[model samples]
Target: MKNILKVLRAERDWSQAVLGEKLNVSRQTINALEKGRYDPSLPLAFKISRLFERAIEEIFEDDKGEENA
Candidate 1:
């Protein structure tokens, strides 16, 4: 999955560790998320959405292509 997590964090002047702290995850997890090395679980996605006050769809996109839509 591709996401604007890095952009969002940058907008808020938040470091990876700060974001991880907010999400109750590790800095490495945040790094992976920002780098698209890992996709967030549904629960984690929700947490991220809630934290940013943005819908999940607004933050993350289906990099596999939106052909289904």
Candidate 2:
């Protein structure tokens, strides 16, 4: 999964810790997400989308070939 989390965080001038605070996750989790080393659960995806005022599709790109097709 590819996500615009880092871009959004940069736009907000938020550190990973601050983003984690807002999302109720750990900094490590935020770091993992930003690094594309982890995929968030569905609920977490929704929460992030809402927080960023974007649709889930806008924040998280489903690059899995089957899903896109």
Q: Estimate each model's TM-score.
A: 0.93, 0.92
lDDT by residue (tens digit), candidate 1, 14-39:
99999999999999999999989999
User: How does candidate 1 score on lDDT?
Assistant: 0.96
Q: Candidate 2: what lDDT?
A: 0.93
| Candidate 1: stretches off by over 4 Å | 65-69
Count of backbone collisions in candidate 2: 0
Tell me the deviation in Å of residue 59 in model 1. Answer: 0.4
Q: How would you encode candidate 2's per-residue C-alpha lDDT over 1-69 as one tens digit per residue?
A: 888999999999999999999999999999999888999999999899899999999988788965769
Alpha-carbon error at 36 in model 2, in Å?
0.9
lDDT of 1 at 63: 64
Best by TM-score: 1
